[model samples]
Target: MPEDPGLPAGWQADSVDGDAPAEVERLTELLRAHERAARGWASGSEEDVLVEVHGLETRENVVVRDDTGTIRAWGSVHDRAEGRMLYVHIVDRTLADDVATRCSDVLFAWAEAQARQVGAERGLEVQQIDTGAFADDERQHAWLERAGFTCVRTWWQMSRSVEPEEVELVAYPEAWSRDGVEFRLVRREAGGLPDEADLRAVHEVLEGAFTDHFNSAEETFQEFIHRLREDPGHRWDHWWLALVDGEPAGALVGTVSESSQGPDGSYVSYLGVLDTARGRGVAKGLLHTIIADAAARGRDRVGLEVDADSPTGADGLYTAMGWGTKYVTESWHREVPVS
Candidate 1:
């Protein structure tokens, strides 16, 4: 690798390899520290850190140091789906904004070069930089805008505290019911992995549910499976599937996040009801089941992210169920022609 021309004096960059123990430890520490300062999430231990670093499709960790050899800033870029899209996570600066910006420029330049290299190897035509910024994070929003990105969509981070007080379950209209509709928690047949048939059904339901949504990328069944498997918090038993007359109609996937740094922090990672199943009790049933499970687990709160402008008005459903917006985040995209 050649030296980055954008790097300011005394700052240096290093590439991290998951196979290298020392590199993993250093990057993990940097990420964990950043999490503590930026978000209330707890930092993962070295072992847990390896899970993320090793699972990424393509990864590059850049560390910036000062003249005194003290670490100043760190950033990582990961490639997903054979190099067509890249996700930037855990970018943090130990120094001030001016110094951080210069370091970030160097890091991004390297990322662009790596993207080009990966694209060439995979025969891809375009490279995408994907990231999300919290609505309250003015600094990050400004940085992203200045870097030529635009906010394209908004997500509401919502949470609801589970209290023992009198609570009533929301019911769907009788006319919304589909014949033979049923709901069940994903169970382990023999081993701990999810049932293949059930998993496929869930994926199908999700695809159908979000078809009309903005920027709904079609995901292959294998890709969906791989994604869940990649998450450190993923637990198969936490998943629920709604069926209409014994066929999958919708699904909700839940996970426990120690990252929340709270006594109650379980999250509903994915929730969807197929188009054919919409307006039925499937969505309500799934939410009820998931919330019950979370409460049973002694979780303090349950949370999920929803598109604020969803055509289906999903955010309203969540709010009606007692969820309140904790924060907002925006997704920005710049589509590049595949050709």
Candidate 2:
């Protein structure tokens, strides 16, 4: 038997960045290729993915290779959600065929180990790890089952093409508004980065709004801010906040989808409204701001993900506002005990 039976026979795994510059560049290329195969879109330039790799706070990244030393997979357990939840992103192109059984086995073991480590450090009895599979990817679904991840949620990747003429008419019903609610663009510091205080306020609003969300967890200030900054398309001017009676009541962070749609379009990275702000026009107002900005900026469309089963019926709102699901993805999760 191999020293690590979870790995394919004669295959080996190593840290993603344990070597020289050339190796890092090669791994980045591998990552790009793997991502394109998995998601139908290339991840980013080498520099872009490297920035993301370095920004991860508590992560274990690995590259797997066969005996001939050709890299076949990349996997990571990224603790961006502060140990309450870990994200497992793995892509395999091993000769083991469409199943990728060995890669799934090894990657999942690594993720569970990291989950346990972080949960113990945080004094928690359990922590959950999440991973995604395309809704129609049966091979990946089977692999996830073998790794013990239960299919937890389905999400829609929704997008709406926009024209300048319709931006002003996009619906934010006047009746949904309480008096004195308004949307404001986030301002930045001298370097054109979001002012630190404003960024923190956005994070705080998101943390509060998602308290009742499925599998929710608070991403730390540092993690939340830096992880978003790592995106090559990120920009301060794209962020916004909503105010009700001059108090911060909602927040939305939008990023240019340069990798997929270029500067001609943007994605709503996040949208949240305070508990007290719910049932008001805050969420819709924030989304309206995004579409209007896209129109004003000459962008083609705005895109976002919505929980398929959101209690608030967010999907209904998106569809009513002209967004349609371009594709669907599923989240699979497993909880690991600290002990």
Candidate 3:
């Protein structure tokens, strides 16, 4: 009797299973390699980098191999309900021609099935699959479009090279001061988390600030905390909070990301000002604080991504601060029912 050929003669698919240490190590190594390759190719982290594949609430990996048993490509699905999102984080095809097409077909089919499973579990009618490709990555973009995804939003990967002398002149806007309003950079205390109350205040400010923006998902307090904790670079000291009339009004959350694909350095992960606080220059003030902090920390550069079409015209603010657009990426969204 001959050995059974899995999925015809030239193709094989396998489901990645088990949480064994070896399995986790293999997945992490694969993910890191994928990330490095993507950064080398695209100048930044892969949009779908899966940092915690083993701990994802819902995930499935499909590996396609050739007749020689060498893995050619893999895909994965991660489902999160807090934001009511189903993210297809991994879809890579190293094979060429029919083999690649076949692998993609199997991958997307698995993703759709996973989405259906999530819907069944949550009693929702539909779920979204969000993906992005570097502006230079036309091939991936084409693959996504051909797979029924559409580009809905674009983001700019912006950066400002650190020059201490240049940054010294980048003063916090003094013209828009509010009486009794104060600004402070968060600092780490011995074995202490950032003041929880201060963090909550910043969360409230962010929620109120971005309410009208595109795909502005309303994050619960817990969700905000969960997200910050998940990031490998999250640091409380890098955060800044603004108070208007002694009340919290705006904030900037900064962190050091290995994802920058540049020198290890601080990045302004988010910058926001509440609607009522916008005209007071709080956003600029917060940004100035973060940039100065990054420079003082000996960081090579400070980077951030912004919606190209932000209503507040944030890109202009960043540009004025010496940041230049390094690259662009488009977000592809598929609408699915909320319920």
Candidate 4:
């Protein structure tokens, strides 16, 4: 049984059953409201909420409801990798400040206990709580600071407008070359599934490419594949590979984006070029391919996130490729010792 997070009188912590329609709807609305407050716009749907909370075996979720049975706060923890856990903290922005702070405290306490539980299950002595906030979200920053999390990094959320003419402007044939580097989509077999060898190559290239990036942690190949597959928009054809001298050297994994107010878009979930192939236009080729593919599919934009402090000047590269900053966010982390 999960431990209870002692809350103020008449408030109680309970587990979230992702299969319940009412539960899903309530959570979705809470998340969207939180985003709307932080960013002036929101993008998540009920489908996104389902993808997040459905994997009960790999995730822990808690919700606080008042005596009136109204949910006012939620906390979810994902055992993302061997040593890392991801946290989602949401409280009703409409509540009074003191009441909201108390609710936030209860959620954070629940999260810490859940973190230790997951850490022990994974046979680790310490676990990291990774969470994010919009750049201008001062309330969230205050909550995180009071909970002992440190602001570690900043990111630029960027997007590029795609036009049908880009399909002619950017060459994305099955096989294309630039500066002695070759780019191609990961091949699919008769079963409509990606080739295992190509999948492994893409994973290896990405694992190597991000080795020196901020907070880099080792994620097993199985974990990588499983996590990516959990996304509702995942598609086999969105995976691309780059080669130099016919050897795997870079990769870009994309996903379809669903929008209620506008045309759907494409998102660059992962993009990396191995150090050995960095200067040969491998990254540029992969970017152009995704933009061209999005245009061909009538997607209006392509979106991605980048480290604000990247030493490689990656944001500059995105800007040069016609991508502009849509918004900014920050990473907040807290390390907890497992009992």
Best by lDDT: 4
Candidate 2 lDDT over 153-229, as tens digits, reads 99999999978865574343111234577676776678876677777888899999899999887778887876787
Whose TM-score is higher: candidate 1's or candidate 2's?
2
RMSD to true structure for each model, in Å = 4.3, 3.8, 4.9, 1.6
List TM-score per model, in order. Answer: 0.83, 0.86, 0.81, 0.96
By TM-score, the candidates rank as: 4, 2, 1, 3
All models: lDDT? 0.68, 0.75, 0.65, 0.89
**lDDT of each residue in 1-339, candidate 4, tens digit only:** 234455667788888878889999999999999999999998878987887789676777888898888889989888888778999999998999988998899888888888888889889899999999999999999999999999999999999999988886556645688777888999998898899999999999999999999988888889899889988889988999999999999999999998888899999999999899878888888898998888898889999999999999998889998999999999999999998
- Per-residue lDDT over 1-339 for candidate 3, one digit per residue giving the tens place of the 0 to 100 score: 013422447767675544555544454545555444454443223222344444354455666556776555566655543334545443343445565565666666666665666666767776777666666655566667777878888899898887665345334422123345567865446677677777888888888888888877676787677766666678777778888887789888888856444557678887878877767777777776776666666667889999997777888988998899877778886654445
Q: Cα deviation of 6 in candidate 2 (Å)?
A: 5.5
Clashing pairs in 2: none
Model 2, residue 183: C-alpha shift (Å): 1.4
Model 2 lDDT, residue 220, Cα? 80
TM-score, candidate number 4: 0.96
Residue 243, model 1: lDDT of 81
In model 4, the clashing pairs are none
